[model samples]
Target: MMTVFDRRSLLRTASISGRAALAAPGLLRAQALDEIRIDWATYNPVSMLLRDKGWLEQEFQGDGTRITWLQSAGSNKALEFLNASAIDFGWTAGSAALVARVNGNPVKAIHSFSRPEWTALVTRADTDIGTVADLKGKSVAVTRGTDPHVFLIRALADAGLTERDLTPVLL
Candidate 1:
């Protein structure tokens, strides 16, 4: 008899192997897990999709692990939850993750799920603020320690302006 492998079979085998490897440590402990807290943010469509699909529940069904889903308003809240040990896993922007790491949060970036444009500067339709320079001396609404804040800062800097040049309404 001869053994043959196709691309789909190879991928399926790899996926199963990866899952077993991840579960090895927990299985070795021979302890039952009560719950696994995970966060889902509005900005992360994948997280939302997973929660809706009940995939996590299915994965841990045999282990009797409870999948607790926490809602995060933004990266700051997600990072805060992670720092407070409120969540076992979370979703956040790369910039926010870097900021949290820099601020001494014991965090790591394991995956990049999406790369859509996550931040932008907007003004009223009637407002004449067509450029970043026009934002100078204007009050810009932003959430501190979030991707939008980082984007605003970088955009301002690129326009040869700083936060001091404008009024930042931290939310």
Candidate 2:
């Protein structure tokens, strides 16, 4: 017989596995966890669903653990929260997470819930910015330390340009 797992079940399984991995070392020390802070980002629908369903709360109720749900406005915010130890788990873009890890944040990626194609370079229809090169002297609004920023940087590099060639308005 074959069994199919829905989105909820998949998220639950991943969450449980991640939690187990994190708690294993602490388990040897007999550490008691009183609270778990996790962030939900708008870009991650699955996280929103998990938060709305209160699955973490239900799972830890027997252990008297409190599940605190936090909102991450962007990958940059998520990384900040992780660095500050404000949250135990957070949803962030792979690139953003990698950047944090490279910067010695001691973060780990437990699960990849989705491969998103959400980043884009857009310009006003009235503007003459037709290509990456056209953005050389333009002002680009970007959230630093996020996936979009990485994408923009790569795009600029590909065009033989850099942020120095453009005005990057940090959002």
Which numbered prediction scores highest in TM-score against the true structure? 2
lDDT of each: 0.76, 0.80
- The predictions' CA RMSDs to the true structure, in order, are 7.4, 4.2
Per-residue lDDT over 1-171 for candidate 2, one digit per residue giving the tens place of the 0 to 100 score:
323447668557756765775666644335667888889988777678778877777777887778898898988788889889999888888878888888888887767655555678998899999999999888999977777898899999999999999998989
Best candidate according to lDDT = 2
Model 1 local distance difference test score: 0.76
- For all predicted structures, in order, the TM-scores are 0.77, 0.79
Per-candidate total of colliding backbone pairs: 0, 0
Model 1, 1-171: lDDT tens digits are 323434454334433543454465444445777787889987776667667777677777787888899999988899889899998778888778888899888876544544555567889999989999999999999987777887898999999999999998988
> In model 2, how many backbone clashes occur?
0
Runs off by more than 4 Å, candidate 2: 1-8, 26-32, 157-160
